[model samples]
Target: MRKPCWFLAPPVSRAARWRGRCCTGGWRVRALVRDPFSAGAAALAARGAELVVGTFEDRAAMRSAMAGVDGVFSVQPSSPGGTVTDEQEVRYGITIADLAVECG
Candidate 1:
């Protein structure tokens, strides 16, 4: 059987969880990132994850990235110096959920 596709959004925490998923050799991980050239993104790519270039703020991008995903793992940064506002975070989370429903 073919592996299910999992879309991971905003892979913070050094993407440890994402790396674990990649190493498990079951699901096909599709990680979203603003910069595909970034070190973290490169690491994920090295671990067999397919990189999708975009931010959570872009609904179109998110939807596009989630086109064939069977599951989604989204995380929002909560650093005191983070730029995203609380309302934006909520909106992005909702957007991801909505997209998952729409895609599924």
Candidate 2:
């Protein structure tokens, strides 16, 4: 099977709030965000999507968490990954691209 399409990478705080129990699925239906830990999986549990979350930036941890996952959704940190490379401008573009592909 092909790699699973990663959908969203909403912050842990946001995903924890609107997980499951939707209100006509307005913003809730925009796309799923996969955060570290069980946040993403918990959020998607009620939506019929098997999303898995964990501290995958840790290689071993990421591998373990993504063992069965088909794809990943991620964004580099604004400072280290973004500021270091001074590519903060590309952050939004990357996010949009990821969203588009995941939504498709």
Whole-model lDDT per candidate: 0.73, 0.42
lDDT (0-100) at residue 37 of candidate 2? 41
lDDT digits (tens) for residues 4-97 of candidate 1: 4656545557657766665466777777878999888888888777777887777788888788766777776544557877887788778888
Off-target runs (Cα >4 Å) in candidate 1 are 1-4, 9-11
The backbone clash count of each candidate, in order, is: 0, 2
TM-score of each: 0.82, 0.32
Positional deviation of residue 66's Cα in model 1 after best superposition, in angstroms:
1.0
Deviation in Å, model 2, residue 97 alpha carbon: 15
Considering every candidate listed, which one attains the maximal lDDT?
1
Task: Report model 1's TM-score to 2 decimal places.
Answer: 0.82
